[model samples]
Target: MSRETIVLDHLGGHEAAARLIGGRLEDVLIDGAAPRVGTIYRAIADRPVKGQGGMFLRTPDGPAFLRQVRGLAPGQALLVQVTGQAEPGKALPVTQKLLFKSRYAIVTPGAPGLNISRAIRDDDRRDVLMQIARSEMDGGDLGLILRSSCAEGDDDAIAEDIRAMVDLAAAVVADAAGDAEVLTQGDGPHQMAWREWTAPADVITEAGGFEAEGVLDQIALLGVAHVPLSGGASMYVEPTRALIAVDVNTGGDTSPAAGHKANIAAARELPRQLRLRGLGGQITLDLAPMAKKDRRQFEDALRAAFRQDTGETALVGWTPLGHYELQRKRDRAPLEVPQ
Candidate 1:
């Protein structure tokens, strides 16, 4: 019951919806929710109609503002829907959008199809990357995975996303030549991928209950150890797994064979619980066996000391009843100290 993310970065029409670009607007957000829009590539739409016509081919990396765009010609294709109210002022930027697409080449308003693939015009970036990879192999859409920051990105970020999709397809073809409204855009990169998949002990966290300061700065940036429990306090210490089960409350460091010192603290806490909880699957550690070593080759050298932190994980052995198993990567949870 503790989940919070309140971003407000620059949100208010990228230059007033770049003054009419391929339009599209609907319950966008700034306070509401649902805003992860950053498509890298993958689009399809040959002929269909809803707000008037069809052929959208822009699924992700939003923004398309046009007054005319037509550079990545070749097999030609263009369409857009935009709307506005972007917000920002003292310069702008607060998460603003009104439906924009063109994180690469093609954007029309004609001037020879506006972008000529950043003037390198290799037939205009192979005609918008072969019409977005042949509309994801024969249009019906959804096949994007070209983000290494769009790899060879140059020509000034492909001519500013083809002049922001020819100023959003010349203002959704000028609001289809009349009224207005219906275009939307905004998603400047979801606050750097949520601060690059956050970590800081669940962000200086609070248990089933919650608090803020950006979740205590993401639980003190995931190093965990935020003790204090019971009430107006903290909790996270989580860590343990990669085939775990270290029961060495040690108490006063008393030893002898405190079970081979809890089997060397469960082989040094199973590589710090497979690197702090980013665990892998089939794990099933249950240590405390090393009656002076020889415990099945000291657990096969603890599965060869987890081949340096289970990069590929797959130990897959040790079950004559002592447990261990491995295989790795089970989608998460059990970091350690969880018993």
Candidate 2:
């Protein structure tokens, strides 16, 4: 019953997508101009690492990391998909496993065969959709993964989506005529979010728009020294070159029960804050001093909230210093550098 909205801000030479839940910025996607992830390019395989399973690919966007596979060879022309944006001095990540995404599903050239969405609880409906996917694929080498949206669609609709994806893949392969070229342009952040969450309430681009202004203000708040949580507590979020650290403070609530309550409150909002800021990689949460029972309760709240995130986030265990460790896959560059 949560009301969600998507806002696209294209101002000051930046394009970003902010997803708001109950008028709060829950998740944001930043769209960059060039060399974005999801773009497909034709590249030449560079030298391969002997022991390591990675190789360099000479692409139009620059050299990228390619996972060494059986068919990949040095100096050979290969088609690759950008997996992640390049960091300050690092190269972009690319993979040979080409994939085309549709509204209902994603088509892959890899060996994943067919996978129905786990969100669909009805076994009979899932089996029916799987059969439809298989029939549409027709024993081809292409693989298909029905997205969560597929649960709302019928078999015929799913089949049509698969066909469209397959056709689009064929068109992209045909367009890859040169040694190094961009075959398919990647979707902007707004488009990507729309596909993931379905059409939003409204998409505003004007600089002075109300929703746009609100999202911008929220982003600015994300840069402040401390983030306000319930129970009058605050969190100090700091991102380092190696990892991100968050320290929870009770703001003068010195009682043990108060500290434990503050930590639990912060735990509930930490995941949403992390996604809003697009802070990925290793994260260390410095919890308030609490008993073992309180720690377990705090962790439970943290995991439950993080489960709503689209990213593959994992709770890595607590540190010797009572800090909880978390790891999230790096999908793109940080939306804003920590101040």
Candidate 3:
């Protein structure tokens, strides 16, 4: 497979967008924006509301909520990391735990031990990386997950990356404990895409005056009514308040075989569509109506296609009405939402 590409589009003002490989809009970030997911902040606990269970915390980005307020009181300072952004009418979600990510590993403070990425399926290789983590961590509480990229680097480079992450985490903790209101700024999507991808990506910007790039135009497709597929079929994709819904239409084909082929094509496109649009949470697919046996066959094909996704996905089986249920964990907001 070819390595993914990253496109950095800087719209006028503070706004910017990062499109990952496959023309998928990954994330949009802004300068001086509200605390985003993975952002760390210094939070001062406030008095609990009369009936509210979680206490409000005064953070640099704004107020956040600590759901389990045990042992925390007003005027107490705490280090918190942003778990999720503030949704419409919802406050930002934060946690006391913290994590640091580098090219090779993810370092988690206040967590125990080390884990190897499941992508490193070779048992012998897993054992070697595990031993390296154990030896380098040296009984520290910082946890490490050797990312798949670790396989590309030798022990010395991996150890250096881990040590750098550990040091960065320690510095963040110290900063959060100090008088500074802001602990550390989170990485923008452009920087993050570069770090996460296996190969380097060319960064483009509107500021560069590149008129031929259709990336900005493609952003509008996130809200497109339907996407045409081969075999005269199309997939209807829309995001509801609850979840994303996809409907497969055998546009011009009526034969049983045609419908089956369209279903297979839709299944193949679903993963790319989801990633491209950055749509997550629960996704329900309304496949073309078919017999029980055909539906089973379609389900198997869909499951096989979904396996290609890196995100955690669950095939929740098909409904009697021919609706196929599945869910993908939300890493970021849908592309339709402004960053």
Provide the TM-score for each candidate, comma-separated. Answer: 0.21, 0.88, 0.79
Q: For each candidate in the order shown, give its overall lDDT on alpha carbons.
A: 0.35, 0.77, 0.72
Q: Looking at model 3, report the run of 10 residues with the lowest lDDT sum.
A: 23-32
Pairs that collide in candidate 2 are none
Better of 1 and 3 by TM-score: 3
lDDT, candidate 1, 1-339, per-residue tens: 124233322222211000001121100122223222331122222233245332223323332223223333322333333222112121111111122344444332322222122323356555655455343332221122222233346545544554455455455544432222234443343332232222211222123221223222332333444322221222233334323332223333345544454554455345544544344444565554445344655566566676545245676666677655666543222222211
**What is the alpha-carbon lDDT of model 3 when measured against the actual structure?**
0.72
15-98, model 2: which lDDT tens digit per residue? 667777678777777766557778898888888867878888888877888775676778788788987666577767888778
Pick the winner on lDDT between candidates 2 and 3.
Answer: 2
Candidate 2 global lDDT: 0.77
Across 96-127, the per-residue lDDT of candidate 3 in tens digits comes to: 87889878889988886788888788888788
Cα deviation at 318, candidate 3, in Å, is 3.8
In terms of lDDT, the poorest run of 10 residues in model 1 is 15-24
- What local lDDT score does residue 8 receive in model 1, on the 0 to 100 scale? 27
